[model samples]
Target: MASSIHDLARHLNISIGTVSRALNGRADVNADTRQRVLE
Candidate 1:
């Protein structure tokens, strides 16, 4: 699967690591951002 994690992180002003963890079902992701990313 090709994910836009880097782009999403940049637009959201967060780190790529955060985006990665979030998509992988980590507990540290911000709810709102995660939702947007998923969408």
Candidate 2:
């Protein structure tokens, strides 16, 4: 099953907001961190 954003965040050990921001391509997230999430 595909994971929801909340599940993904929990699994990744990061905040839900960070996952959301990274997925949305927001500028506030660090580039490396965003890349790690996407991978």
- Report the number of the highest-lDDT candidate: 2
Q: Which lDDT values do the candidates have, in the order given?
A: 0.82, 0.91
Q: TM-score for model 2?
A: 0.83
For model 1, what is the error of residue 31's alpha carbon versus the real structure, in angstroms, after optimal superposition?
A: 1.2
lDDT of 1 by residue, 1-39 (tens): 765878888887889998898789898887987887777
Model 2, CA-based lDDT = 0.91
Report the lDDT of model 1 for residue 26: 90
Which residue pairs collide, candidate 1?
A: none
* Candidate 2 lDDT, 1-39, residue by residue in tens: 988999989888999999999999999999988987898
Clashes of each: 0, 0
In angstroms, give how far residue 35 of model 1 lies from its true place: 0.6
